[model samples]
Target: MDQCITEVKPIKGFYKLSMKQRMGFGAGDLAQNLIYQTVSMYLLIFYTNVYGISAASAGIMFLIVRIVDVIWDPVVGAFVDKNSPRMGKYRSYLLLGGIPLTGFAILCFWNGFSGSLTYAYITYIGLSMLYTLVNVPYGALNASLTRDTDEVTKLTSTRMFMANIGGLAVGYGVPLVVKYFSPDGKINSKDSAEAWFVTMLIYALVGLVLLFFCFSQTKERVIMDEKDTENVKVSDLWQEFKHNRPLRILAFFFITAFSMMAIGNSAGSYYMIYNVNAPDMLPYFMALGSIPAFIFMPLIPAIKRAIGKKQMFYVFLGIAILGMIMLYVISTNEALKGNTWLVLSAQFIKSTGVIVATGYMWALVPEVISYGEYKTGKRISGIVNALTGIFYKAGMALGGIVPGLVLAYVAFDKDNVATQSDMAEKGILWLVAVIPAILLLLAMYVISKYELDDATIDKINREIESRVNY
Candidate 1:
């Protein structure tokens, strides 16, 4: 085994990861999800319910923050690539960027200050920027960890598994924790703001702890070539954008898939509160979304091996759309009103498809990175990650903007104790079901355009290996 390890074909540089090393690489993702999921799942609710911001104002804020991401993500990516810190280029940011990320995330949910809009702008924008600071490097760190294709796949699966651990914690635990802190077990009641503050504070602190663990576990192995580092320019990003067709297809697929998940997840709080009239069930519904990750995530590699990646995408995405259609029809049907079991069942089914399909997409990033290196003799890992970061952030923006705008247009009232108006209920239903259904359909189309299959990536890796041997 040791001889085989030493005798394996080499690229410009090579790194081998033990199981412990691979699991450590994935710990970073767990830390990341804790912070990111806080914003993704709870921020909208915090805005409307706790801080008392109008949905329209929150929507505009979301769009502005995403636009700000346009400038910020590339800078973080490039900064990591150009400068190497003592701890390592990418992992250093976990401590530097993550501590503040934790603080800002907590602040975003705080209601101590009366300046809702100012608090919203400061905390949210800070959270977004700090998140990019940590996230971009973490992504770059993944590429730097190893060059082995199969190893990266295992690493991605492990990362996603740990990531879902964070997601599950946030999804399943937050509401229960919040309710415990609420004045009398009512999250939508007058004391809900206090509950939110308490819950976010705890989640943030726990997230910071995990960030430290991630920092302790991972290290950079396949460092970029120094001469190539000297030639690194942001303009090189555009060159890849122009020549890398698979990257473009992947970028669009990221947008569509993320948009689909975001739109659906964002609207979940509203759907349970208004349309279903069982606000307590929101956590269960949200938990349902992450549960599939546990079930299907472990099966991804085997599934991909059996059916192929492209076919796997077509299969899961089609199932996702069908689940959404079921949700829409059931939610909108008068006969199904008050049927909590039926509604939750549909959500569980819808999420099964969404979670597995989306979770597996992260594995493709390294493949595209390798493909770029094979084609151009340059491996700008930062640039590829930055581009995909933009699309994923865009999806998050749509998640924030669309539901807020739709609810605002339909006149959703945050202050109301009773159910929302009929029109608002319809809007929530559409947000949960129809809109995501459309986005999933588009995702199927975009993923179909992906040209790099396993065979192609394997071929590229072999060619690169052959060249290095001579």
Candidate 2:
């Protein structure tokens, strides 16, 4: 073991990152979320209401695509680990995969093949698969950068902050842009296909630019040696999962946290358009979902220092539940529903908790990776990230499935734009509030099972580095 460890060298300045590198590293996530958040939040609505697809069909398609991800993620993970492309091991995909990702993303919103499930299947599946190619590598890139727990924490905060900027842009900007281009000046109108296409095209182009920037700015300093790379296998993904307890805990947490966020996000449009009876307020409400990240995310390092990690999760998760309860109460009450201030206030409160809880989870990824390396004596960031990706995508699948199923079950009439049935409105409300609240509760429980605290992970990282140095 000592002889094996002696072959590798400790990375110099592993914990230090310049602000430019941090910001540039973050831009990749920002770019991804700009396109992905739009799909997560609006694609279902677009499919059922505007693009002329059945809710049930779209729901099944979502599940199928994510199931595909379960298989594809491991393949991508193993492939990425084995190959070191000329551009960079992980960064190459940022451009290679990103270009196609942008094109498919734009095509997903186009209505040229109106009401065609084949068109939806072709474009949506393409977008999802290409996304994996980029995402798995991007996730691995985080652990590749450094092993310092504090640096990873700070890096994660910046990444989440930038990611939410994309979320904010998608949440608020998409609607506003689509509305501006719409002939009727309304996003919900069936005739707004042209508007959706144009908006997505611009967003996709911008996302490609940011991805290129991310590729240029980031470097991978702490990575597996070529010999270690040669040993990586797809089956190692499961092998690591079996032995890595923290990864399991974190993976489950991903499922629950992402499910909560996804369900709430998917339900936002219906909540604003139907429950609040204020389409104009949708942008504000959606934008507020991400805006809290700007204020709270930067304070994460301090917040963790003060409260400790688990307590932070407990506090924020509780706040999220409270906000959801408030939203449910206000929306159900006819008089209170019309008051946009109250609704927006509830949104801000809910988002603060959701954003902070979920945002901080990314920081835990490196800890788990370090833990895995400490135990297994192998650093396979790709496989570990692939496992997390599977679970998060599983969570996202629920986000897609639940809303579509609820809309179908409630018998939502796409034709009735003026007002949905009472049952449908209640279902949308449940999706926005009650469902997410339950998921938040589950998330809190799952996070509690995560055993690695900063002190523990810091020790593990040092031990791992010592081995490499000796």
Per-candidate clashes, comma-separated: 0, 0
Candidate 1 Cα outliers beyond 4 Å, as residue runs: 1-16, 465-470
Q: lDDT per model, in order?
A: 0.81, 0.91
lDDT of 2 by residue, 9-117 (tens): 5355255888999999999999999889999999998888889998889988999999999999999989898889999889999999999999999999999998999
How well is each residue in 240-268 modelled by candidate 1, as lDDT tens digits?
77888888889899898888777787788
Candidate 1 clashing pairs, residues 3+ apart or interchain: none
> What C-alpha lDDT, on a 0 to 100 scale, does residue 280 get in candidate 2?
92
* Cα RMSD (angstroms) for every candidate in the order listed: 2.7, 4.7
Q: Return the lDDT, model 1, position 459.
A: 81
Runs of candidate 2 exceeding 4 Å displacement: 1-13
Best by lDDT: 2
